[model samples]
Target: MKAAHAAWRGLEPVHGMIYFVPEARRRYAELGLSGRAGYFTSRSAAFGRASVELVVSTFYNFNPDLVRRALDGAWDVTTPQHVLDARYAAADEALRRAGLHELPALDEVVALTRRAAESACEHAQGRALFAAHAALPWPQEPVLRLWHAQTLLREFRGDGHVACLLSEGVGGLEALILHAATGEVPVDFLKASRAWPEVEWADAQQRLRERGLLDGDSLSADGVALRRHIEDRTDRLALPAYAALGDAGCERLAELASAFGRAVVRAGLLKPG
Candidate 1:
């Protein structure tokens, strides 16, 4: 379980860096998106069958109206499927163009990723978000299939994470605020793309303060502990996907994936925070 979780952790930085990569940003800009709003909406539509409302409710955790606005902007630029296709293509292309494929053991890494993702999806059958995503037709290409599989694994874990958050009485904006307080993600990034109204954001902040989770812009010690608990539970919830791999398999997968992650970092695609 530890190995599987660590393997996922290893691949995560590489997969997630697609959003931060300049090559991806340039591709979105070509489609008329001005900033991160365009990137979020267009790229998120990779789950083409899921509604904008579902996207907002699950992954985004942003204002629905603002999400709608972003989707509208996205449609003005391209169709939903087109947006998804372009995003998949762009991210994949960025990796290849950056010469990541040339790295030693990358083929083995992709194969292991495919294996892990396939196993995770099989276990994810009844999961709401994963089920929704799984209902989509498979992509023809290898790269696209890897991307879709990775997406399913992520959403499956994310749905479980949301369940954990709900059990802890944490809602969407509160979750984001807590994440910010933990200093994991940048505050500006969260505040900018989430599109919460000033009143709503302030209200969330105030509520966190009342709960002893916030001290101005930072997390109180209790807040940090709470956030850590949330993350620990989230990791636990995600372990089942990796548990199928066993310890050695997971360790090998993590070792291979780390190479790709390093390639991503070396490409200057991810910005330091």
Candidate 2:
């Protein structure tokens, strides 16, 4: 089980870097987006083109009005399929540019990823968070299937994370505060990226401190323990997808994908944390 969890986490960067890599951002910009804001806005437009409220409700943690502002006229710039293609292309180019395009193990990773994603999709039945993505069409290309699978896996866990946070009575700002306190992301980046207001951010800090989750500017010992518990719970919730791979399969997937993930990291395709 632990190996399965590790395999999923290990492969995360291979697909997840598209959102943060500068090359990918450039690709989105080429698609008529202004910059990162346009990228996130147009990319996350996958929750159906209804209204900002619908996106905000499903997305969570992001400021509502900021979501509205970012998504304003997003569809006019690019469609979801186009955005997905560009993201995939960026990853593809980065991998190729890094000389990984011809790697022998990549195809194995893709096959394993697709299988894992299929298992996850089967398990995703009736899951509200995954329903939106599950309803989307799958690509025939092996690499694209890998990306799609990772996306579903991410959303599956993301939706679970939101549930966990909500159960703890935390919302957007508080969630950011807790994340910052955990030292996973800096407070400045959290505030700026999420467009959190100063007054509300301060209030959230006070609230976290009251909950014994914040000590000065860091997470308290108790806070660390609590956050670990939440993460562990979320991991357990996501176990079924990995379970389909079985223990040996999980280890092999991780072993095969680790090099590619490392290449992505070394190429600076992901931001330094």
Best by TM-score: 2
TM-score of each: 0.84, 0.89
The global C-alpha lDDT for each of the candidates, from Candidate 1 onward, is: 0.71, 0.74
Worst lDDT run of 10 residues, candidate 1, spans 41-50
Off by over 4 Å in 2: 125-129
Candidate 1: tens digits of C-alpha lDDT, residues 100-216:
757777657666766666676666643676766666676665555555656666777787888888888889889898888777888888887677888898999999999998999
Global lDDT for candidate 1?
Answer: 0.71
Please state every model's RMSD to the true fold in angstroms: 2.9, 2.3
